[model samples]
Target: MTRTLFALNPGLDRPAIAAALRAHGRVQVRQFLHPDAAESIHEVLSRGTDWGLAWAATGKSGAHIRGPELRAMTPDARARFGLEAGQSASKGDFGFLYAQYPMVEAYVQGWNPGHPLDLLLEHLNAEPMLGFARDVSGIAEIIKADAQATLYAPGHFLTVHDDTVVEEGRRLAYVLSLARDWRPDWGGHLNFIDDDGDTIEGFIPRFNALNLFTVPMRHNVGAVPPFAPVGRFSITGWFRDK
Candidate 1:
């Protein structure tokens, strides 16, 4: 694959996407990026990114375990951490366990100086991608966005919660999937749950699909089954007004 700047498809149906957002508060744009661009992006996530562990347990405010620390952990230590996180979830705590590359944080700290992921973050925050987000969501004053690369391996999950942060200025949450050939039984789907604890809708991870939804909606990334052979790869974050 050639090293190239990321580009939007230019042929997206903005009006249709906008309409769907208005009706359902969410929409999935399939083939969201140009084919070549999509392939290039998948290559970055699949082979280029150095993933880290992102997990949370009760009373733990710091969630990220950066790549270096993750690499230093023994297999037993990693499993112990996972077990603790699982235990927290079983006890009704808000917790999540997934591999993450904190894009915005990395860009700020120069973690991988001059990497494409940094450039990708810039592409998301600048035009025409920024402008496109405004047009589709009808949420003007969306000045920026923050992102993180995520890989949900077997047993990784995000528990149900509404994305509500008053200080964060988050208007909508988005996910761009790089996962392909994912099976339904693998169980890493994004599900919207109702107040009654029932799933109202769910979206499977599909290659090159962009899933966007209004914030403050109850949702969770379902836990992957142990028998699953692949990770659910995606770049996810929120569109913000700040």
Candidate 2:
């Protein structure tokens, strides 16, 4: 029988969460999911079979090239995607295979009616959780979501970028971490960037924690150093205004 993903945590304290969002434009909620639900998600992701490699090339012009298209890019083509002389010398400079984006929509769509991921997506887009998200983020018009599962293995990293691509309609960005025994030294921390390109604040990927920030904030996932033993897994995406 398929398991249904349901709220594990009793509820969020709306006032406190809102206060944090208002004060810092970001917030982290610990014990965000019910223990059982979180465990189920972790298990599913850990055992997941279908995942595609995703890479992003940020050109000097600041444009981006993503997904499978990155593979056949020539040196000149790579440069067009923002690879520079020194940056291109290293193999890992402009690309990485350890970084991946799991097709969540496929998982949900291909599963049986009561599949956990399907139920979880439904839970996120509906009910008390949706209402709570609106109230805390103060984005009353947020009616949809765009989310996917992500895996950051050794040497995987995401560079700085604001979640402000106008077409995405992203009002808020969120990450629900599912890594266990994650240590600061392992280096997959999510760091918020200041205007000057310095890291102003950072959050470790704690198990069952939900971290959220307003759109257009510069941020990046610190590289997972080579020695790290496990992948940093999470369900990450945006809350959109429709």
Candidate 3:
């Protein structure tokens, strides 16, 4: 049986997290942005490539893959990352379900400077909810971003990865972890792996927890349900620029 998740708390911050994360590079964890962020992002997603959100459940020959894909703008900003509308080649094993939503590049080019996305960006850049992106490109820098949803069930896992690309010169990824009532045993832990991926050092995900870190390292999410019966859900985002 599937278990219903509890609502996420909008405000979450461990008093010591700020100081601790700074030692590593950067870090923050809090409730995800409002449903407005999720709903509004959905509006933008409609313009992206489409596939049934449930495509993960169906086999490669599944019914969802045969469905129509939505078309969205290919922002010049996203092109730099070698991203393209409807491109699934780069997203990895999670790519199948991840492919349906168009992923945009967010380094060199720019996002819609005046949209709500920008509003959030402005607020975050100046003063994030938990930690601060205070260093220049010297130590770490942060950009702005948005991401859509995907479906992952039991046995599904988002492999650990890092955001730092030396050539890309982008460091630090700040995410607002959305979704709630995630049990430790539900097995959807966003394991923060060390450079080797052999050990889990830290994690900050729960209702209202915010996660911030340097990128291009290596990390992965723990396995999903079936080991447990709860499906995981979250709307997340990152901050980066260099």
Candidate 4:
């Protein structure tokens, strides 16, 4: 039997979430998943080490390369990807690990059939959850979901950008936090920016919380400082329309 990935709180009904999204263009649902399910998914991601290093220079295609391959890029290629020429490839900023959607689904189903993450993604893209997303975002044609596991270790960060790639069909963006007992002071906040480039709000990664927002909004992941004891982990993705 496929396990239910989320057990919605009674207070977090569809209408309530829709109201919040309508008012703010974003909403966060706390305790979004059952404790056992959340724990299992968090365990798997926390112990797994097969993460690919992902990086991108401004206006360049993001590359997922191993440590050695990143070291082997030509000077021009490095510069184009926002890497400093002549500097050690591993020494620059802008780095994170991402397990892309398809690979993650395949790996989980192949190795641990009916894994929580797989089931969670399935649930999110179907039925009441999908309907809820559509209703809340007021985007009736949202028909697809894409997701990936992201890990921001010490010193890792993503720069400001509006998720406006229309070709990707993204209509809404979502993040499910699996980090436990996270601290705001340790960084790794999901921050929103205004037109003047000022930060208006930010969210700490709280375990079992799901954050969803309209796409094309400006945002960035705050850097995880070196002294932070734990890495920030989440499953993040976009809801798309055909």
Point to the candidate with the largest TM-score. 1
Candidate 4: TM-score? 0.78
lDDT of 2 at 130: 71
lDDT of prediction 2: 0.73
In what order do the candidates fall by lDDT, top score first?
A: 1, 2, 4, 3
Candidate 1: misplaced stretches above 4 Å?
1-5
Count of clashing residue pairs in every prediction: 0, 4, 27, 1
**C-alpha lDDT of residue 134 in model 3:** 41
**Rank by TM-score, descending?**
1, 2, 4, 3
TM-score for candidate 1: 0.97
Q: lDDT at 203 for candidate 1?
A: 90
lDDT of 1 by residue, 1-242 (tens): 47555788888999999999999998889989988878888888889999999998788853888888988989998887688788889998888899999999999999999998999999999878889999999899799999999999999999888888989999999999888898899998989999999999899999989999999899999999899999999999999997
Instruction: Tell me each candidate's RMSD, in Å, in order.
Output: 1.2, 5.2, 10.2, 5.2
Scanning candidate 2 in windows of ten residues, the lowest lDDT window is: 58-67
Worst lDDT run of 10 residues, candidate 3, spans 57-66
lDDT of 3 at 172: 55
lDDT of 3: 0.44
- How far is 139's C-alpha from truth in model 2 (Å)? 0.9
- Ten contiguous residues with the weakest lDDT in model 4: 80-89
Q: Which candidate do you rate higher for TM-score, 1 or 4?
A: 1
